[model samples]
Target: MAFLELKNIYKSYFLGKEEFPVLKGINLDFELGDFVSILGESGGGKSTLMNIIGGLDRAFSGEVLLAGQKLNHSKEASLNKYRRETIGYIYQSYNLIPHLNVLDNVALALDMTTLTASERKKRALDLLEQVGLQDHVKKYPKQLSGGQKQRVAIARALASDPQVIIADEPTGALDSQNTEEVLALLNKIAAEGRLVITVTHSQHVADSGTRIVRLADGKIISDQRLKPAYNAKVESKLQSRKLPLVTSMRNAFKHFKYHFKRNLLIIIGTAVGLFSVITFNGLGTGVKGYVNEQINSLVNPKQVLVTPYVKSSNNNQRSSYVNLTAGDKTVNTFSNKDIAALKQVKNVTKVEKIHTLSNVATSFNKKSTNITTVTNWTSVLNASSIKKGRLPKTGEIVIDKKNIAKSLTNNPNSLIGKTITLTYTGLNKSGQKATITIKVKVVGLTESSGSSQINAIGGNTIENALKAANMSTDVAALGVSASSMNTAKKVAKNINKLKVSGKLRFTATAVSSMLDRIETYISLITNVLAGIAGISLLVSALMIIVTMYMSVSDRTKEIGILRALGESKRDIRRLFTSESILLGIFSATFATIIALAVQSLANSALSQIAHYSFIQISLSNIISAFIISIVISLLAAILPARHAASLNPIDALAGE
Candidate 1:
């Protein structure tokens, strides 16, 4: 029984409905250790017969038997296994992957073996050494001469220890000297217990082999035996399996690195979109914080400003004029009953009487200025804002130096112990308006801390001055203070819920309320900006798709070579997808780095103004950016990878 047999083979081609026969009935027998050369002219079906024998052309009607076992041409998996485990092909063009070096080109054929990484490297090295190209292992195909590239191709074909080697015009492009060397190498491979098949038109080349089979117009004309076949066993202990995912990833990374500059640009472009998204989110958080800092620091955060609910009477002045007896909207004041009810609320640690004396004539050293102060001393005033002196006593007042500085003196501290008088119209005990004057000593000078501050005086002094003028001493507003800032919000909520005869009587406002309002606006604007930046991400995804498609086009021959090495279509798809995902990972990682850098620089530059960070990139923000990048890239790669895997191995090999 023959080691390999081709029985009555027939093949043809078709264009529309026209059939063109390429190979006539062909019967041949190939044995181990036989260096058989198929001698024929161009287009005589020598190469087509080699394709069938190598299990690369499955569209033929024939029986290919190895040890009397017939090859299953109808099933692709069986053909792939036969090609991988038994047949090795050497093309005339060398078909080396341009991006890979000599050593990697050989090692790639061993990807389906169960060998460890180090073992695979060792085997590749051994193979390169065997081919006498050990010194050129690191060189690319373009860097090597014709003979060297052919030697590398031969070494790659032998890497998997295939049972048969099919060389289609193996020395077609080589010089006479290189051709002799390659033919001698083929004879040596046959002597090492493997069938070596070479297709050639040169009689000299055919005469060098152990047997010459001449074909004319797809029909064998003659078969001549030149020498007896050598005898040896062809077997290796190497176990084989399907290609692993790690191999695909490693190959993907190799391609990624080979095109580093182009991929880097893509990654940077992608990072721009990711950076914008992260930065805008951080900006929103920072702006809210800065606004809160300014507002909360102005007064005690635990203070809620409570005022008597003013009615529509202030607008309807004519109606007030008609109902005028002693009560009016101008003196809308909080009664003792209101203050008592506030102190009863939870978390209400303290409450103080507050008076707002607007449009009062304040005089100091023959200089007069308008006064708008909550004149009564209360906890609502941030004590840390006092520049000098202390809170006022019974006959003393604390003046805002920033507001009345020009009206008083160049140095306001000098006027701290000086006398100041305020004149305002007030209702007397008899319910008639009268002019009142209050003489008070300026004990302290305070500055505005990012928020409005008023000129303040002791509440007792104001009440006594009104009493001296025989005017009604009415309380205007109350300062509701809580135990903590958070408690202050709760206290304000409770206060607003208070009503008189089921009518809303008072409204309270806390520092957090103002902060929340400003923050809401900032958040809305930031989200809008971030959303707009997200469109750039879509553009980046499209760029990845284009890049992947270009990659598929560029590596078409490499794809065919890998398929000939028995790599499954699924492996090819994963190979391309792996590169895209790596692009996403690297892009997201670089974006995070950029975000951190911008955050630090922004915070440092603005430290002097608000002493706060205005851009705060969070961990979640980075994670979300990575997710978006990966998902987009993975989706972008799908069509291109599928197209690459769906390619015909024969056509791909023929592609330029």
Candidate 2:
């Protein structure tokens, strides 16, 4: 049986709905140690025929048998294996990877092999020596002469130890001297018990072969054989150029090195975008944590607050006010009836009513300020904390640290136990002036609601004076200690019903309303920030698209070369996408690092400056940031990858 056989091959192409046949019933056969040259004019299907035979193109009707094993049309794996292990190819353009040295170029064919790295290196070097390129083993293709590059290509082909070497105008781009040299090398390769076939239009190349086949319009027109002496010289030369190993790992390294710089830049760009996403997410998370901490610290965790709501004439202008006076000029105030109704509700563990009076003034040697304070609930059950003194008892008062400090013209520490005179206005009885001056011991000081000590004292002290003035106050506004949240809500509802019936101006705690307002504000802020960040991510996606598009354009020729060298369409697609995936991964990793660093620095600085040990960052924020960054990167790469995979090899090669 012939060592390599193509039996009755036919191939065609289709343009739109039109069929175009390129090859018609072409039969070819080659035996071991035979140098066969196929010559044809341009557009005569020579390259297509070679491609079909080399398993690079499969759109044909034919049976290719190598060593008597029939090539199966139904199994893609079989054809791939044939390409991988049974055939070696050489091209006119050298097809040397620009980033690879001579040794790596040759070893590329053996990447999928089981040989150790050192063994593969040695094998590649040996082939380089056979091709007369051993001295250029460490040099990149761009550094070598055209002839040297073609020699590297030849060495790569031979490295596979295939049964056949298919050369498509291998010397077409060479100088006359290099052409002769490469032709001589091919002649020598066939002689070493291998089948060597060259597709060429040059008579000089055909004459050098032991047998020549000429084709016209895809059909063999002439077949001729040279003298036996021609065969003997070719055989002897091939013997001198024999290499022991067929494949090496240099290709993988070459591929990575060639693309490293560009890929690294892509990775860094992606990392920047990812970093923004991660950092912002971290900030949001940290803010949320801080807010939650503040809320918990400020409010009673087990207590639920309820405020009253009153409907105004216009639904849009709901009021918290109630009218108390009647007979044309109505007055608003909580009546005894409203309080009794609230007390009747279940879960009445302990209920305290609060009355707020504003615009109350306090004076310490003519330095006076107005304040707002709540009365009716002054004991421990109503107060949260006192920094220095106790809550006010009968005829006694607890002053704010800031007010004490301002009154004493020093820190509150100096006036903690000092007696301060407070003048209250609006006393109701005759002969008892609205202003009553009273001496009270400064008991304990308490922190204001996120207010400075001075402001807290000023505001609370003024409020205390207003509370003592007997001025009318808004009632049932603050409810403390519910039997349960549900009971408190029910009591609040009953109070509302009573005020409505009595036509009274009264307010009660509406827990749900307050919660709804708080939640709405939080959601609005969160969504707004997230939406802005999302828009930025869209821009980032566009940036990735531009980057990948540029990369595809830059590597078009390289991609074409790979496609031409027996790599399938799927392999080409995978290579580009893998590069994209690597970029995305790197970006996510870098972004996470940046976010963590920022979080750490900000948290440390804020903690030191605030002097309040309340804010903290959670692990969930870091994890969430990382995940969001990765997701964004992957989302950004999709379009670019698709654009790359959709490129046609021919157009890409032609720079179209």
Candidate 3:
């Protein structure tokens, strides 16, 4: 039996309602080790016949039998397998990939096999050497001559070691010397027990083969045998194999390297968005650290601030709770019952009542200024913030550094021991507003390093002054003391549950807890800002998608080449997605580096004023940025990758 048999093949094409018949009732038989040429003129259906035999055209009516098994064109996978293992196609136009070098183009077919990289190269090099083009292996197709390009195409065709070699106008583009060389190579392939079929319109080319069949008007008119068929020396077959995923990634990287400049722009664009997210998060962290440090220094960590939880219009704002006067009748103020409940809170060592006087007048010599005073016997006043003698004592006051240094005297120390006058107006013992004055000495001056409550008069002196004015010194809030800082947090939580008249009358908070709240607020703001930065990432993703789509358009021929080399549709998609992932990795890495450098520079510039580093990029932030960039890149490439993979191999190869 013949190795390949085509029985009564019929093929046609339609132009609207008109029928254009190309091939009709064609019968042919080909044996192994026979060099046969199908000769025909233009539009003689010769190319169509070759396409059918090569498994490239399945829209036909016939039974194609190979080695006594019927070939089913309806099953794409089976046809692909047959084409990969049995036939090799050499087009007249060379059809070499523009971006690849001679060696890679030849090794394209071997890439679909299970051979190792070194072995694939060895096989490709041997084939190139056989065609006398071994020295040009590294040169691209555009850099080669017409004959050299054809030689590379021939090498690529024979790379898979198939049993059938299909040559369509193989030597049409070569010079006389190169043409003879290619024809002689085809004759040698037939002598090695393989079928070599040539399709051409030239009589001289057909005469070189052992058998010649002439076609006219879709019918074979003459069949001549120039030489007897040679006996088979050995049967050869291409092994069935799947291309490894790592090999696909490596090939994708090579393509990336070829287009480095274009892809670098994409990476930089994506990195800018990632850098924004990372830097903003770092800035939030640094600011939180600075605020916590300042807070810890100003207030004693073991003290908890207890205030009346007067319900406010907005939950986020601090309620307006102040010290009660003699005639005041407000119920929102902390009552005696609330204070007694806080004193009972476990771990509470002592409870100190605090008083605040608003809009008071102070004078030293002829200079006077309005000041807000707090009864400052609390533990929050750090000794390091005092710039003068000591804490306020009875009949003496501590003043603000800036106020005393600039308003009353040029030097804060000069104001110490100096007599100062204080005046107050409020409801007196007669239930009417009255004024009173008292004389006091300035004992200390406090710098602006502490809170507003820290710069004030002694609580004992303030109580005495209020008594003299016939005004009430009802406590504003209580300061609860605990054995330790950790104890304070637990005591505050217990005290916060206290209530009066079935209403939440007091709220308790430690300095550490306040710092935690501030940090939480900062975190919320940072995430919101990062969310805004992520919008730019979406734009970058869009840029990537557009870029990949453009790549699909530009590399259509390359896609076709891979498909023809026996790559599955999945492999094509992997190729494009792998490129996108590489871009993501590159962009994320560069973005992290840029963000760290920015953080370092920002801290250096701010250290002069802040006395501490103010920008910190944590490891978690770096990891999140990387994951976001890569995931976005992969998502952006999905549609474009699927589009490239779904393209028909025949149409892609024919694309310009």
Instruction: Give TM per candidate.
Output: 0.83, 0.75, 0.81
If candidate 2 were superposed on the true structure by all CA atoms, what would the RMSD be? 6.7
Between candidates 1 and 2, the one scoring higher on lDDT is 1
- List of clashing residue pairs for candidate 3: none
How many steric overlaps does candidate 1 have?
2
Candidate 2 residue-wise lDDT, 1-656, digit = tens: 77778899998889999988888889988787788889988888888888777776666898888778888856655665666666788878777766667776687665544566687688888988888877778889889898998888888887757767889898889999999899889878876767788999899888888888888787888878773312332221111111122221223234545778766766566566556655555555555555544443334333434345556668645466544322223333345655565556555554444444334455544455554542333211224545565555544455555544455545766656665655445534242546645555555565544552211222234335544665434443445456554555665555555444656434455444454456567657755765665675566556666766776777776665554444555555556545555555656667677766776777778776554423233566556655665566567656765666566544554452
Error of 2 at 127 (Å): 4.4
Per-model tally of clashing residue pairs: 2, 28, 0
Candidate 1 residue 32 Cα shift, in angstroms, is 2.7
TM-score of 1: 0.83
Give the alpha carbon lDDT tens digit for every residue of 1-656 in model 1.
89899998999989999998988899999889999999989999998898788776889887999989998888888877887788777889999999899999999989888889899899999989988999998998999999999999999999888889989889999999999999888988999889999999988888888999999888999999999887987785677788899889999999999999999999999999999999999999888877776565356788998866645546632221112234554535667777778888899998888655657888877888887554777788777667788877788888878788557788877897889888887567776888988888888887764447747786588777767888766665678899898888888888888876675556687766777778899999999999999999999999999999999999999898988888878999999999999999999999999999999998999888766788988888889999998998999999999999999888888898
For each candidate, C-alpha RMSD in Å? 5.0, 6.7, 5.1
Instruction: Give the number of the best model, judged by lDDT.
Output: 1
lDDT string, candidate 3, 11-31, tens digits: 998999998999988999999
